[model samples]
Target: MSVDHATMSGLLAGLRVVDLSRNLPGPFCTRMLADLGASIIKVEPPEGDPSRPLGPLFDALNHGKESRRIDFRQPTDLDQLREWLVDADIMVDSFRPGILQSMGLDFDRLKAINPKLVMVSITGYGQHGAWSQRAGHDLNFMAMSGALDQMRAPTGELAMSNVQWGDMAGGSSMACIAILAGIFDAQRRGTGRHIDISMAHGAHAHLVLPKATATLFAPVLGHPPGAGEDMLNGNLPCYNLYATADGRHLAVGAFEFKFWKAACAVFERPDWVERHWQRGQAPGSPENNALRDDVAALIATQPLAYWAERFEPADACVTPVLTMHEAQAHPLFADAARTQPWAAI
Candidate 1:
């Protein structure tokens, strides 16, 4: 998915950006910007943006960007930052709510430097919420937002699968989109804007489903976090995972009658379809459990490749759970020779 430099000329050709954010969310936001040809000058303090030395993401995210090492507290450094801020089309940062104000880089002050600048400020709990000053990240955000209660590890402990699931996927991803939207609005209105992106709020956006369900049902029902008891929390058989004989897995997501019948047909067990298909209910019911057992037995007879071959061609949602290595080189992506211009990585 890499792009050649020449082919990326006019995407964001003349945009100048000053990035003051450190670590994951801000850098990831800027990385997407860099990918589109924005000239981003990442400003860091004397000690440096922590992510520059944060071992993992350097080579990948910071590839096409430049850095400006300056102590924004010092008079000269402030002068230089002001110069960049005054001229930049957009400025981004991930400081806490009032820390930017304390650091003399607040949006009001900086916007005064360049009224047309689109200022994006990202924070954990947002600027003026009850948990505004509270320290938080992905796991905490997920826990608070109800996105974490559904996933449990084999040990019965709450699973925190990937770090920054909420931070990057929720927070950083949302911030980048909001920033782009602000830029578009500025382009149309002829006046730049100040965007306050709350990482917690971004994380909270993922709670729409649970929140709506809880609200809709709260009058008649109860809250979630009931584990396998909750409706959409993998409590049913038709929408759950089954373990194979070799400890591999299969995702049986036959959430509808049509898909359920297709799955049963694919497994050559049509009787199980209507018997186990509780389309509107959750996973642990007798019908779903029986179907789960059937699928478990059927899929374990062969390896993942064997199952994929039969099911993939049929467009059955029944899929062999892929490992990390298998996913990158999977056949789904091995069609470079078939596309019009052919694929280029």
Candidate 2:
């Protein structure tokens, strides 16, 4: 049977999500749920969501969701919020541990009104931690979780990435997954569960690469080498970033042996094909460093456009580093860039 994906009933079509969280994480989670056809009601304070001033980001995250302004301190507004919660399937909040309870919106109280209500609390630490009440942002969480430690440059200096790994990937992404799990559990068990998402802990969970390679390097090794230390971290010539003649950058991620062989062939360095990671050459060794330098110099001989054209039809992993504007205009993301409002069920 043929099915139309756009016209089909969405996975979360019957779900109702009430977002009390502000800023990025909670709002982003609800936005994703809204995309999956869930009805999202974003309850804001009298002054509105703190992220409202962020312009494009606010519009992107809060679109297709209904907004209500309420003062939690006011009895009338609290009563109105209580009414809204009675029918909500999921509730997301980012307040500190006791803040919601202080506002008389505790899990137990809300469950008494509606037992199947899935409550998700997103925080910097967690519900039962000493740092639960501490205020922290994306960089703070990444720093606390050792994620920032792994982003060192070649000279052992820590590099700052513009992407919000902790806030968006760790916090928001985990919260989304947990909320869906909560929804499934509520539907099957007829009882909702409280989801506690700590942004720092979530970021820590994403430190998988370091943990996987822990045995390779001793803990006594004071500051572990970050860049150019491991195959995935830019040690190998075939899987690193290179600069073009025009000062533009190219990311060559030919990690597998076959792909690396293909890339070597494309670069007219057929002799380098045998120098794979498992070829008994230790990562970041003199030989590997020499190879990396050779690749960099070779790439720099040509402009970005030249390499882009050469690698376009080739199966080898090579791509030009693009700015945000360029990425948005790319044909691959053309469909995704047209952010439509959540379709009606």
Candidate 3:
């Protein structure tokens, strides 16, 4: 029951949190708060958090918290649950809409007990909508929101599934932000508020950039992948991925005209400066393909180390395409070794 005095020194230092949901978003949001020194008591429905055993990434995320995965099926524990919530400052949940209400921890009841409580509910959709009651995960949410359709490869292979594109992208991130805002409002207004978070809404929010690409810029650019077909998505001479001689890869992310000019100067490929890789054109057309091929050949002439030496000094965003393991060993990431918990975590 004692708090870690030194550990609880961050901004959210004395806050007590009750995390009642499982899986990604709920845990991720609370984990972030916990990192800031909040006292988080994860209250699972007796079976433990589903994400606790989710592997390498889970180990990397779930740290600095007290977990009591006690099954609430037993009648005796509900009394203890009430005791835990009576003074808890925040409650974070991710059950689909009404599932928590059915279990009897709905905001109304908790607010009655602790009027200043901040109840955060992160669902696939929102509290009320046609799809509000629908069952979904990150992929389904993103798929319906049109966020996924807009993230396809130029060649249009299988749809990519970057897990938590919704759950973490803005769902948990937004939930955490709302909870913090609610906490501040409760302090100033002397009243609590229920935060009904919608993962679908958050996931859709992540698509703002891509969605505008289609709706806003499609007219000028002639649609297709819209802005996706623009220089950034593996379609331009100045910005794309290339293979090196040792079968390694490097990433070039220059977007601004000046940066593009710098990349050209770096490679002594000034011919690429005025090449005009306007969007909406054929991806591998004769001219574009030749530029990509030439860049590929130019990079392939040297090993990744040579390219790293070449690019690191230029401060261009150009970088070696490091494998996951290689990335951890990278000098930039390796400097973390001296930074205590960040490196350890």
Candidate 4:
């Protein structure tokens, strides 16, 4: 679990970043940059970041970064912030579209101060749109992007995800990519770029595969799959979740013919090998539903441990569903301390 920070410390050794963001998205983005050896100066409000009260989360996001208190309401403090931006390689913020302009920190003014500064503006929506100035959080962005609709339970009830997909994936991750690309381009062209990242737009972009499948089969299926009706979701017996006798779950991801065949062999249901999607078994069809029911019934007869042991040597993609704590303790995550240095502290 030991990381050679000396080797990683020079990745972005000379980079200077001014982080004017609070809470999750902006802080997470800068945290990643800091991990890659960028010097991050976290510009907090006079009262500090709102997330500071969250304890561990704040520490996890702001570790290894310098902190500076700046009151934008004060002209002198704003001037000091501008001075810092003059030599900063990157600047990140999460204000609404016109908020920074009102505070005299707009991209145009900053560009004049430092033409080579890469400015990243992360928001719920883009810089210009009807919802650009709207107040929203992760759930609102996911709902707007149709991402939430796809996360539904077997009973057709919408399930809320524990992870902040919009904030972390759409906003933070996309902003990091945009920042790196902008830095590369600025280094080449000798001019910085203002990158506008919309969490909703980025979330929508992640649905490319599902969107394509829906479009490709909408004409034949009359409508897109709903809830547990999709092939990859829960329609096929070969690729689905089954409850064990102990009430635990097993994730069966035997999508391909080879894996499905191997899983069928493990279940002693060799006859079910050919009843697969690749062999013309239409997902969610009556035959597939019957096969899924049979498989589920069989799986329910055994405990999760039995299946886990059975599948340990099987080539099938079957795996026992472990709780978060169990996953953390698993050997797969044994080196987590190396990547999450703050966890060790």
Top candidate (lDDT)? 4
Find the 10 residues in a row with the least total lDDT in model 3. 336-345
lDDT of 4 by residue, 180-249 (tens): 9999999999999899999999899899867887876677678997778776777789889999999999
Candidate 2 achieves a global lDDT of 0.85
In model 4, the runs with Cα more than 4 Å from the true position are 1-9, 336-345
* lDDT (Cα, tens digit) per residue for candidate 3, span 96-161: 777767767788887888999988888888999798889888887777776777666656654667
**For candidate 1, what is the total of clashing residue pairs?**
6
What does candidate 1's lDDT look like per residue over 134-169, in tens digits? 887777877776667756743356877766767786
Clashing pairs in 4: none
Q: Would you estimate the TM-scores of all the predictions?
A: 0.85, 0.93, 0.85, 0.94
| Clash totals for all candidate models | 6, 0, 2, 0
Model 2 weakest 10-residue run by lDDT: 336-345
Better of 3 and 4 by TM-score: 4
TM-score order, best first, reads 4, 2, 3, 1
For candidate 2, give the lDDT of residue 32: 84
Candidate 2 colliding pairs: none
lDDT of candidates 1 onward, in order: 0.73, 0.85, 0.75, 0.91
